[model samples]
Target: MKKNLLMWDETLFRDPEVLEIDYLPEQFEFRDSQIREMAFQIRPGLRGGRPLNTVCKGLPGTGKTTSIKKVFQEIEETTKKLVPVYINCQIDNTKFAIISQIYRKLVGHLPPSSGTSFKQVFDAVARILIKEEIVLLVALDDANYLLYENEINKVLYTLLRSHETYEGTRIGVIVIISDMDVDLSRAVDARVASVFRPTEIYFPPYADAEVREIMKARVMQGLFTGVLSESLLDLVVGQTLKSGDLRVGIDLLKRATLSAERAARRSIEREDICGAYEISKYLHLNYTVKTLKDEERQILRFLAERSINDHEMNAGDVYKAVRESVSIGYTRFYEIVKKMDAMRLVNLQYREGKGRTRIITLRYDPIKVLEYLS
Candidate 1:
C-alpha cells in the first residue's frame, strides 16, 4: 500500500532547484574582481602561448569553484584556441586517474581502462593537444590532497616536463586550495615550482550584505513571491554570517522550504526555518570524504551507529567498540581518529586529569550521515 505523505496544499517554491549549491544563477554576485584576475592570467592562452600557472585559494563556500567554472564558461564561448578542463582531486586523485580525466575531457570519452598505461595515456593526450594546436588549461580543485600523498610534483612532472618527451606541446595549470598559505616549496620540489611560477589569487569571506544579495537572487528565482518572509530571510542571513559560509544559508533555505511543504503550510514559518538551521550547522566540508580509508570508514560507521543511543563517546571506549567490528589495532585506531580530527571531519579532543582520556564528537548531522553512509 502507498503510504500517505502530509505534503502542503500550497506551493512555497517556484523552482526549488535554484536554491541548490551547484546551481548557476542568471546573475553572479560579488566575484567580479576575482573573475577579472583569472581572466587576465589566462588571456595569454588566446594568443597561442601558455598562460601563467595560478593557485586559487579560499575557504569553503568562498566561491573558488564557482568562479573558476564561471570564467571557464566565458573562455569557452570566446575562443577555441584554449581548452579548459576541471578535475576534483579528491575524486580523480591518482596520477593515472588525473591523466585519464584530462584525456577524457579532450578525447570526448575515457581511453580503454584495461589496456592503457600511464605513459600511453600521457603520450595520447599530448599528441591530441599538439595536433589540434590548442593549449589545455587544467584546474585541480582541492589540490592539497595531491601534495599530502606526495603526488603533486610527480603529476606536475608529467604535465610541465612533458615537452622533454612530447615536443611542441604546451599545458597550463591552476591549483585551487583551501589553505591559502600552504608552502609550495615544501609540498613540491624546486623544479615543479619553477615551472609552475604560480600567481596566487585569494577569495575572502563574503560580507553580510553580499550574502544577502546572493540569497535574494536565489530566492527570487527559487521561491514563490509571497511565500518567503522578511523574518525568515533575516534568520538565514544571521545564520550565514555566524557560520561564515554562504553554502550554509543556501542549504538552510532548501531544507526549510522542504520542512514547510511537508507540514502542509503555504508559507514557511519560523519553526520550519529553525528546524532547517539546526541541520545546517555542520554542512561545510571543503573537501569530499572520498579519501577515507576503509578502516576509517568503518570507524565512522561504528560511531554513527553509537550516536543513535549516545550523543558523545569516550575515545578509549569507542576504540574498544570499533575493534569488535573492524580489524584494526588500538594504535591505528587512535591514529585514524587523530587524522580525521585534523581533516575536520569529526571533532576529537584530548582530555586532561587522571581518569579522562579523550572525547569524540561528530561534526555532521547524524541523520544525514546515516543516510549517506548506509
Candidate 2:
C-alpha cells in the first residue's frame, strides 16, 4: 500500500518559517529605479543640504510605503545626524495628532495632551529642534486623509516654513498618497504648496509575471516541502490581478496556508487554494466592517443590492439607490465615496468621451457578498 505524503497531526512538525512576508519588500520583486532615485534624494542630506520632499502615490499594496520605509531604515543605519519620523494619517488624521506623533518621535517623550494649547505645543517643538540643530525628515503616510479636513495647509505651513520662523532650522516633508491625480494644489495655500513642491513618485501595479515571481519566492521561504502546487500559484496571481490589489494577494496566501494547517495536511493541494478563497471572502467582509464608517457601510450594502438587480452601476445610479434607503446629506455622501475609493472597496473611473461624468463599480463580486450576507 502506498503511503499518503500529506498525512500529519498537530505534533508532527515544528512551526513554519515565513520570511518577512508581511513587510511588502521581502516579498517585493521589482522597482530597482525607484529605490535608486529615492536614495539619491536623502544622500545629499549627509553633506549638509536640504533633504528632498517626495510624494509617493500608488494604489494600495503597490509597495509605496514599504519601499520608502526600507530606504529609511538604510539611511538611519548609515547616518546618525539625520532624524526620520513616519506617521500614518489614517489613524492620526488630525494636525494636532500628527504633530504629537512627530514630537514624541523627535523628543523621545509624548507631548502633554493637557494644559498645552496647539500653538504652545508646536512652539516648544520648534524651540527644541532649533536648539539641537537637528535635521528632520518627516514622512506623512496616507497624506490625502488630511487634505479635505483643512489640516494639510496648517501642518505643511508649520513643518516646511519652520526654517523661516526659527532661523537656521531645516525640515523635510515626504508625503505618501494613494491617489496620484488628486488636486491638492488648490486645497493647500500657495505658500505651503510652493514650499512642498515634492518630487512626485508614482508606483504602478505589479505585472502578472512579477506577481508570480513574488509568490514563488514567498512560498520557498515560508512553506515546508510539497506545499503550494504550481497550479495554485497561478490561481493566486490571477485572482490578485482581478482584484487589482496586492493586499488581496497577501491575504489570499496567508489564508490558504492556514487552511492547510487546519486540515493537518503536510502538503497544500488545489483544494487548499480554493479553501483560501472562501476564507478570504470572510476576512474581506470583516475588514469592510472594521474600517468603513457607518454611512460607507450603508452605501456599500445598497450597491450590493443594486448590483443584484443590474450588473454594472455608475456613481450617480449607486448614489441614488443609496439615497432611497437613508437620509444622507449630499456633502457627506460624496465624502464617503472618496473614502471608499481610497480603501479600494469601490472602483472609480472617468467615462471615455463623457465630460466630467464618472463610472463606479463594486470592486468585489456581489454574488459572494450577497451569499455571505444571507
Candidate 3:
C-alpha cells in the first residue's frame, strides 16, 4: 500500500514550468492585435520620447494582463533604454505602495516598510530616472480595483502627471481595467485625465474556435500527447465559454490534469474532467469566501439563505434580513452588495418595473455556500 501510494505517472508533463499560471509561453496565440498595439504605444519610450499612455480594457481572463506582460518581456530583452514596471493594483492599491513598487523596479531595492512618505519615494524615483536617462513604462494591472478603493484618480494623477513635477523625467502609464461598469475618466481630475488620453485597446471574448486553438497549443506545451482527449478538451472549452474567459479553461484543464493524476491514471478521462470541473468551482468559491471580511461573510450567508427560498431576492431585502443578525446600516449593506457583485459572488441587476428594485442573483451554489462556511 505504501509503494502503491508513492507510484505515479510522469507521462504527461515534460516540464513543470509549462503548466504554471505564471509561465509565459514562447508562442502567444489569438492576441496578435493586443500585443502589437501595446508594443506600438510603448515603443516611443525606447526612443527617448514619451510613451503614449495606454489603456488595455477587457473583462477578467481575456489575456489583457498576459498580453501586456508578453510585450514588456520582449521590450526588456531587446532594450535597456526603457524600464518596464508592472504592479497589480489589487494588492498594492494605495498611492504609497504603488510608488514603492515603481521605486523597487528602478532601484533594485524595496522602500522602507513604513518610515518613508509618498513624496519622498516619488522624488527619489524621479531623480533616478532623470540621472539614468531612461523611461519607465508602468502597467497597473487590474487597475479598476483602485476605483473601488477610490484610489484610481490618485494613481493616474501620480503616474501620468509625474513627469510634470520633475523636469526631463519621463514615465509612461498603462492602465489595465477589468471593470466595465464605471466610466473612469469622469472620476479623475481633468488635467490628469488629459495626460491619460491613451490609445485604448480592447480584448473581446474568444470564440469557440479560438478557445480550442488555445487549448491545443497549451496541451502541446504542457501535457504529453494523448493525455487529454479532444472530446474532453471540448468539454472544458465549451464550459469555459459560459464565462467568456480563457484563463478559466486553462485553469480547468490544469486542475483536471491534477485530478486525473491523483487517480493514478495514465491519461485524463471524461470522469477526471468532470471531477476537476466541480472541484475547481468549489475551490474558487471557497477561496473567494475565505477573503471576505467577517461581516461580509455574514452578509453572504444571509443572502444565500435568502436566495434559497426566494431565488433572487431584492438587494434591499437581503440587507434588511441581514441586519437582524448583524447591525449594519442600509448604506453599508448596499456597499457590501456592490462589493459582492464585484467579487462575482452575486449578480446585481436593477429592475425598471414592478417595484424598481435592485435584484440580487447569486452566481454560486447556494447549498454549497452553506456547507462551505459550515
Candidate 4:
C-alpha cells in the first residue's frame, strides 16, 4: 500500500489587498474620475488664483476620503504652489482644535492652545499663506457634525473671510459630508452661507455590476488563479447590494479567502462564501456596539425587544417603552433614539403632516442584538 498525503499551497491563495477597516488606502478601489476632477479644480489656485470651494457628499466607503488623498498626492507631485490639509471633524470637534490643526499644517509649528481666539489663528494662517504665496485648499471630512454642534459657522466664517482681511492670498474649503440632504445654506446665517457656497458633488452607491467588477479585480489581485468561482462572486455581490454596503462585500471576500486557506483548500468554493456571510454580522455588530455608550446600548436593546415583540414601533412608542421599563428619564431616551438614527442603526422618517418618528427596525436581524446582549 502507498502512503497518501494532502498538499496545499497557501501563498498562492493569500489576499494582499485586504485593508484593516481603519487603514484608508489598502482597501481603496476605483473612483479615478472623481480624483482627477478634484485635482483639476484645485490646480488653478496654485498659479495665483482662488481654488474652487467644493462640497463632496457620499455614503461611507464610497471613496470620498480615498479619492481626496489620491488628488492630494497628484497635487503634491505637480506643484508646491498650494497647501492641502485634511481634518476629520469627529476626532477634532472644537473650533480651537480645528484651527490649531490648520495652523500646524501651514506654519509648521504647534501653537499653544491658550490665550488665542480663533481670530488670532486665522491671522497666523493668512500670514503664512501670503508669505509663501500659496493657495490653500482644506478638506473637512464629516462637515455635517460641526453644523449640528454649532461650531461650523465660526470655522467657515474665518476661512471664507480671510481673503478680505489678509490681502492677495486665496483660501478654499472642500467640505465633505456623508450626504447632500443637509441644506447648509438654510442652516447658516445668510452672510456666512453666501461665502462658503461650494460646488456640490454627489457620489452614488456602486451599482451591482460595478461591485462585481471591483470584486473580480480584487479577487484576481488578492487570491490565486481559479480560487473563486462565479457562484461565490454572485452571492457576494447580491448580499452587498441588498445591504447597500461595500464594507460588507470587502469583508466577505476577505473572510472567504481566509476560510479556504484555513481548510487547506486550493480554491474558495460556494460554501466558503456562505460561511463568510454567516460570520460577517457578528463583526459588524461588534463595530456598532463599540461606538455606543451604555445608555445608548440599553436604548437599542429596548428598541430591538419592542421591534421583535410588536411588528411596528415608532420613536415615541419606543421612547415610552424604554422609559416605562427602565429607570432612565424621557429626555435621555429621546436623545438616544436621535443618536441611533445618526448612527444608521435605526430608520427615522418624517410623516409630512405628522412628526418625524423613528421606524424601529434594526439594520441587521434582532437575533444579532440578542447574541450581542447575551
Candidate 5:
C-alpha cells in the first residue's frame, strides 16, 4: 500500500473555494487603510445622502475590487437606503449595459432586452430611486474599458448629473482603473470633468512580507495541514513577487496542488510549483486578452505571428498586415495599438529618426499569445 497516494475519495484542499480568484476571504489582510477610506466615502449613503464619487487607481491584483466588494457587503448588511451596485466594465462597457445592471439591481428584474430605449430604462431607474428614496452607489471595475470604447464621459456625465434631471434621484460613481497609464483627467471631456470630481484612492502593490502573510493565510484556510512545506511556500512567494501580481501566486498555489494530486501525491512539491508557474504567470495576460474586441484580438494575432521571426516591427508594418483582413484606417489602427499598449499587452515605443516612426513589440511570448488567442 502506498502511504503517500491519495485515495479515491481523498483530497488535500480543506476549502477549495478559498483558492478561487473570486473568493472573498474572511480575513482580508494589508488593506485596512483602503477599506476604511472606502467606508468613509460611502458613509453618507447610509444616512440617505449620496456617496462620494471615488477613483480607485492601482495595478491589477492589488485588492481594488476586493475592497469595493467588502464595503458593498457591509452596506447591504447595514441598510437599504444605499443601493450598492457593482458593474464590471469589462463585460458591460456601454451606457445601456451599465444602466441595465443598475435597473436590475433596483427593479428586481432586467429591462426589455431590445425594444426598450435607453431613455425609458434610465427614466425607470431614476423614478424607482426617487420613489424609494434610495441612493445609488455604482462601482465601475476596470473602467479603462469604458475609456477604450469612448463611453466614459457619457457614463459619468449621466450618473453624476442624474440629480439635475430627476431632482430627487441621487446617483454616485466609483471608477476603478487597473491601468496606471490611463489619465482620467485627459480622457474625459471638460464638461464631464467639471461635475465628475472624484477623490482619488491609490492602491499600491503589496510588500514582499505582506504578500507572504496573505498567501500563508490563504494556504492555511485552503489546504490541509502539512500539504505544503514552509520552503515550498517561500518559493511560491518569491515567484509571486517576481511577477508583481498576487493573483499569479494564488493561481500557482491551486495549480501546484492539483499537480500533486494528479500524481497521486498527498503533498505539493517543488517541481509542482515550478511546473505550475509556466501557466500561472500568464494569469493577468489571459484575463486582459479575454476582454478585447474582435478587432483588437485580430491585431494581437497578427503581432504574434509576426513576432516569431522579428522581435519588433514598426506601427506602419503592423497596420499594413492587419488591414489585409480587417477594414480599419490608419488612425483607427493607431488607436487600437495605443489601447493595447495601455493594457500592457504590448510595448509601444517611438523611434528617433527622420520619419519619427513608432515601434511595436509583444510583451509576452509569441507562442503563448497565439495559444491564448486560439
Candidate 6:
C-alpha cells in the first residue's frame, strides 16, 4: 500500500507540461496535411517573396492555432528573412494593438504607449521591414473576435494594403477563425475583400480513432506507467467527444490523475474520472465567458435570471432588458447576442412565426454562468 502511494514530493506526471493547454508537443500528430498546406502557403516568404494570405477555419480545439504555431516555429528556426508574428485577437482586437505586436516583434520593443498616431507606428513597421528586407507573416488567431468588435476590416485593410503604402514592403496574414459561422467574405467590405483574398483551409473535428490516438499519446508522455488504465482512457475519450473539444479531454486527464494521487492510488479509477468530468466539461464555457466584455456578461446575467422561470425569451425582450442597464442600441445588442451564440455561451435560433422572431436561450446552467460572472 505504501509503495502504491505517491510521496509528497513525487507525482504521477512524467512531464506535467505536456498536459497543458498551450504546450507545443514535439510530435504534433494527425495534422501533417494541414501543416503542409500552411507551409506551402508560407513558402514564398522564405524566399523573399510575399506569402499568400490564408484562412484557417475550424471549431475550437481542432488544431487551427497549433498548426499555425508549428509552422511559425519552423519559420523562426530556419530563417531571418521571414518574421512570423502571432496575435491573439481575443486580447488585441484593436488595430493599434495588433500592429503594436508586429512592431514589438520586429523592433524588439514596444512603441510609445500614448500620443502616437497609428500612421506613425505603421510607417515605422513598414520602414523596418523594408530596410531589413524581411517578409512579415502575421497570424491572427481567433479572428472572429475582431469581427465582433468591428475591427476586422481596419486590421485586414492595413495589413493587406501595407505594401501599397511602401513600395519595398511585403506582408501576409493568416486569419485563424475558430467560429465556422463567420464568413470572412461577407464580414469584410468590398475594398478590403478585393485584395484580401485568402485560400481557405478547413480542419474538421478529429475522428474517434484519432482522438483515442491523441489521448493515448498524451497519457504515455504525461503519466507514469500504469497510472491510468485502458478502460479509463476510453472514458476520457468519450467525454472529449461529447464536449466536442479536445482541451476538455486533456484537462480531464490531469484532473483525474490528481484526484487519484490525492486518494493515494497508483492507478486512476472510474470515480476519479466521473468526478473530474463534472468540472472539465465546462472548460470551454468557462474560458469563453471569461473573454466576454462587461456588457456581454450583463446580458448573460439577465438571461440567467430569466431562465429561473422561463427557459427561453424573445430576442427583443433580451435587448430591452439589456438596454435598461447598458447604453447600447438594438443593432449592437443584436450583434452581441449573435457573438454570444457563436461562442456557444447561448443558443440563438430563429422561429418561423410572425415576422421571423429570434429566440435566445442559455446554453449552460444559469447558476454556473452567474457564479462565473460574479
Indicate which candidate wins on lDDT: 5
Per-residue alpha-carbon lDDT of model 3 for 1-374, expressed as tens digits?
64433255354565556666567888878899888888889878989988999888888777888898888888899988799999988578889989999899988998898888889999999998899898889999878767766788888888878767898888889988887775667767787877888878998877789888887888878888778888887888886776566666677778877777787776788887777667655545775677566888898898888778788788776776777779999988888788778867889999988778899988887898877866
> Between 1 and 6, whose TM-score is larger?
6
Each candidate's lDDT (Cα)? 0.81, 0.72, 0.80, 0.73, 0.92, 0.91
Per-residue lDDT of candidate 4, residues 1-374 (tens digit)? 22221155335344455423333454455676676667667767777688888888888657687778777766777888777888888666567878788899877886876788877887787788888888888888878767645678888877788777888768888888874567766767877878877777777788778888877777776677777788877888887776566777778778877787776666777888888878764565666566565777787877777667675667676766677768887677766666566656776665543655456567657767766865
| TM-score per candidate, chains pooled | 0.84, 0.79, 0.88, 0.77, 0.98, 0.96
Candidate 6's clash total is 0
- List all candidate RMSDs to the true structure: 4.5, 4.4, 3.1, 4.5, 1.1, 1.5
Summed over model 2, clashes come to 0
Put the candidates in TM-score order, highest first. Answer: 5, 6, 3, 1, 2, 4
Ranking by lDDT: 5, 6, 1, 3, 4, 2
Model 5: per-residue Cα lDDT over 37-68, one tens digit each: 88888888888888888999999999999999
Candidate 6 per-residue lDDT, tens place, 110-224, comes to 8999999899999999998999999999999999999988999999999998877899888999999998889999999998999889999999999999999999999999999
lDDT of 1 by residue, 253-299 (tens): 99998987887666778898788987776575423455765777788
Candidate 2 residue-wise lDDT, 1-374, digit = tens:
23543455542122344423345444345877787877777766666566888877787668888887887787788876677888887667677888788789777887887987777777877787778766778888878777745578888888898888778777888888876656666667888988888787778889989878876777776666457778878998787777676667667777777777676666666776677666664555554445455666677777777777776667776667677788987678777777667666677777765566667677777776655454
Residue-level lDDT for 182 in candidate 3: 54
Candidate 1, residue 204: Cα displacement in angstroms equals 0.6
Q: Residue 18 CA error for candidate 2 (Å)?
A: 3.5
Identify the runs in model 6 with alpha carbons over 4 angstroms from their true place.
Answer: 1-3
Question: How close to the true structure is residue 288 of candidate 4, measured as C-alpha lDDT?
Answer: 57
- Alpha carbon deviation, residue 118, candidate 3 (Å): 1.8
Off by over 4 Å in 1: 1-10, 285-287, 290-293, 302-339, 347-372
